[model samples]
Target: MKLTALLLSLSLTASAAIAQSDAASEARDAARDLEEAAVALQQAESSRNRIKALTQVVQSYEDGLAALREGLRRAVIRQQRLEAQLVQQEAEIARLIGVLQTLGNNNSPTLFLHPQGPTGTARAGMMLADVMPALNAEAAELRDALQEVRILRELQLGAADTLQSGLDGAQAARTALSKAISDRTDPPKRFIEDPVQTALLIAATETLEGFASGLTDMSPEPEGLAPLPDISHRRGKLDLPLEAEILLYPDETDASGVTRPGITLATRANTLVSSPVAATIRYRGPLLDLDNVMVLEPQPGLLFVFAGLGAVFGEVGEVIPTGAPLGLMGGNDPKIDAILSQSGEGSGQDRTETLYIEVRDGKTPVDPSEWFNINKDR
Candidate 1:
């Protein structure tokens, strides 16, 4: 009886161990599935966002081209008018030259004809002196008019070149966007039918702060997640997401006297936005007045908030490498818009859109300028 009981206990213990191993395997597989689903969904969303931004870029280019063409037309017209006036001035100078030559040629003859009179000679000399200054003035005026015409012609040529460049850029952007859209693979089937998480995302659309705080509760914490690098030591060493100028600094008050806790960057519409550091996306959505905002966590207790996006990419729980493309700015850039609107404006002022970024050490907001490589001027 003792031998039989010992054998039975060994069998039970072996069976229990097997069951535990199987349970662990199943849990790991389930976690893998969840991660895969999340990644697939984020990829799809990123592709969609890219397509949208590219579309906007095409539209902006079209509008910009139209504006440029109109400006060129005006410039051409002005040049034509100036050329006509220039020609008239040239003819007037020619006539004056002939008159002066005739006077010079007749000077000796006039003196011979008026041999008995010194008064006539003195009067002729005075007249010649007076006419010389007027002639010189006319010649100077003609030269000035010619220079103006030349400048206008050059401006017209420059406008044509700029317009062509813009057209080419737009076409290239469109082709890339189209190819990307076409090559996109569909996300996993399970991600599409997830109504619970979908409902939470939809409901959390009221404000950015709310969405950011509630993101932790929307899904289970990811397993085997890697930690990001320490940002506190990387001040001034960090790369900016986009090439931009700092428009507003933290602690600075705006026209409304509202002090800001973050910095605002002046960037170009359609310029690439990117991750400033390696981090997981905590929140990405439109907020009350901030447009689209992306909340990223680079460390356990630090969060980076970016706003004023026309389009956003990435999903919550997705890890992003530093300098990865995030999205693009929206709207016809005021600077670019102005460039298109005004004649003689260079393309250099394309930096127009604004991005607002805030850094939070846990729940407290801190100045982002300390953590980022801020360009004071573009």
Candidate 2:
């Protein structure tokens, strides 16, 4: 009976160990699943942000163009009215010239004496004298009106021409803005799928299963490992292509403060760099002002990666993955370095050149430091 008790005790100990192992495995699996779910959420949010930004830009261009067109229409109408007034003034001048000629013919001294008696001639002369000054004054007034109309017409025409020019410029601007908006709209065409989240999810799931399997193997009375909890049931848990870093932080004074978050990234080159959160190809082509731009969405917005020693990606809209090779660190401008050094001098910190990396949650710029694990020293 003592021998039997010893065997039972050994069996019990083994069973307890197996139970502990299974529990640990279960916790690990849960953690992995949570990480995956977080990644998916990030991707979804990134895509959504991109779409929102493109839409706003396109709408702004449309609204501006519409306003310009309306102004042009009003200008054209004013021009037409001025042109009509000019025509009327010219006709009145011609009528005045005809009246002056008729009076001159009737008042001639040879015709005045031959055609009529002394009394009639005297009366005609008085009438011509009285009317001549009035006719001359009236003619002069009509001529002045004609000149005024011409001046007014010229001014209106100039205004119309200016409006037309503005309209043409607006059209060009709208086309460019439209193209940019279109490039960002269709996701599949522009955005290369980054499978980082998906891969992490799969690996996490497999690791969990392996742990459970190991526990089962150690158990003497090996029933298959206890069933894992179902993670698939969780909502918002498996979206992919989530953003992993923010390169630029928003500024407090920008329009983003009202609608989305404002970003501090400047339009100047080398102000920031970013992980486009998708798989992309490097465009090693001709350099332009917009060089080092990665095309995150092939059809939509181009993510410009600035070039310095740190400004690595050179090509317009080249595709790149999250945390991929951006470029080496360097400062494009000396002033920025000096400013950094001055700020750090007070704290006895050495001035260092840093790369600007930005993650645009669509059009809204968010602080990338929030998402990326930049604390390598830690």
Where is the poorest 10-residue window by lDDT in model 2? 235-244
Clash count for each candidate, listed in order shown: 0, 34
Candidate with maximal lDDT: 1
lDDT of 2: 0.35
Model 2 root mean square deviation, Cα atoms:
35.4
lDDT of 2 by residue, 72-132 (tens): 3333343344445545444444554565567466866665562568887787678667655
Model 1 Cα shift for residue 104 (angstroms): 7.8
Task: Write down the lDDT of every candidate, Cα atoms only.
Answer: 0.59, 0.35
Q: Write the per-residue lDDT of candidate 1 for residues 96-146, one digit (tens) a residue.
A: 556557756885664334453788667656756665565455455545556
TM-scores across all candidates? 0.53, 0.22
The TM-score of candidate 1 is: 0.53
RMSD per candidate (Å) reads: 29.2, 35.4
